[model samples]
Target: MESVFEAFLSFYLNPGFFYGTVLVVLLILFISIFYRLFPNSGFSILFDYFFEKMYDFFEDILGNEEKKWIKTYVVILFFVILISNLLGVFLEILVPVFGNIADTDVSLLKKYIDIPTADINFNIAMALIGLLIIIFEQFRALGFGKALYEYFPIFGKNYLPYTRGNLNPIFDWPLFILVKIFDLIISLFLGLLEIVGHFAKVISLSFRLFGNVTSGGMLLAMLVGAISGLTLTYLNFEFPVLGPVILYFQSLLVALIQALVFPLLIAIFIKVAKFA
Candidate 1:
């Protein structure tokens, strides 16, 4: 009970959790604005025009309409992910402070600064959304019957039950039926595994983003600390002014990469879904 209480308290007090929630809210606001400014029809036209240009760029790499569609999605995904990742950059300043009567606690209440992809829930939610898009594409491509057949293979009578002069015909039919039954059962299990794998992707994606960003920040913090320590050791610790400048540039590059990666991967996911 005590451990559970402590765990709950830690989760509630987590800065990342709160920051992620705030960032999500802000993202929704911007998305709403975009929708309000350009309704589906208008956005579709704009997307189509750009999508065509993108398709042309990938002309050498991918052939046919199917390939072009995937390329189009990838481009759009890059933008969304990139923007969300960098939302933290604007909140580099404005650290929060909390105080209490019992222990005079101080908490960093950041006005801004959130790495959306760092949260597992956020990554999983996006992946699930992408999965839906993929399923929709599959439905559009093959219709219901073909899609079902693709997952569940069934041999027809026309293709079998012949050229059996040397074997028992009755026995062969039962054997074939049993084989198909096993195949169907295996297919069901395979489907379950696929679902689990998708969830695994979400976990990996979230951890990758979180690990990269936090690790980079820690590195920069260490650099700054080391530089300041050396300065203090040699001379009355004036300030590691240059450390901030260098770290800031490094942070900028890292932030940009993370921002781009999120959307790029999403686009790839969309493309893969179409084929599935």
Candidate 2:
């Protein structure tokens, strides 16, 4: 009982967990109120443009009119990642600096400077959701036989991806049987590998997002620290300001591209599974 209590407290007391929960709740509340109260604000205008652009982007990737049903999900996913990425850059900087307020118990926030998407558990959870969606979409779009066919194409078909049967010019009966047996074993091996590769996609997707976001957050944190710690004796003009500005744009591009790429790849996977 004591160990269980300690475990529960450790998890619930974590500053990162607390900050993530509070910030997400606050963000959702602010957006709900902001849109309802001020429909024509500049942020609303910007959001409208972003929505249209993202619609076109997802439509191009997932083109069929039948697939339009998922547009809302895709758009929401893009915004979630993009917003989290943007926050990672700003909050990591802000939380450490302003989080030290003595009057408030929120000073614990300083220790939780890492971004949400930077956490491996968070990325893996999202990736697992994608995995579930992939399975569901494949089954719904392709039906059970065809969807299963994707992984076991060579098993029941008695055919390889390429031409087969008697590569030897001469009619050697035993040699032909040997060749077919070898090819059959190889094809079965490959089909099993295909199934493994499908699950591996989740790991690849998780690691890609985790690595990019975490690296970007860490890089920005270090750059900010180095710039702020610079001495007067080291330099006069602040050319150092340009370093972060340039890196900031680069991180912005990375964040946007990754946000798009993760969903785009999922769409492509579904499309391929359907067609296969």
Question: Model 1: runs farther than 4 Å from truth?
Answer: 1-77, 90-115, 149-182
Candidate 1 to truth, TM: 0.59
- The residue-by-residue lDDT of candidate 2 on 91-113, one tens digit each, is 65454446445775343444554
Query: Where is model 1 poorest over a 10-residue stretch in terms of lDDT?
Result: 92-101
- Candidate 1 positional error at 122, Å: 2.9
Q: What is the lDDT of residue 50 in candidate 1?
A: 58
Cα lDDT tens digits, model 1, 109-225, are 331234565556666776666566656666677688765654444432222334333458778677767756676666666656656766766666666777776576557556766
C-alpha local distance difference test of each model: 0.58, 0.70
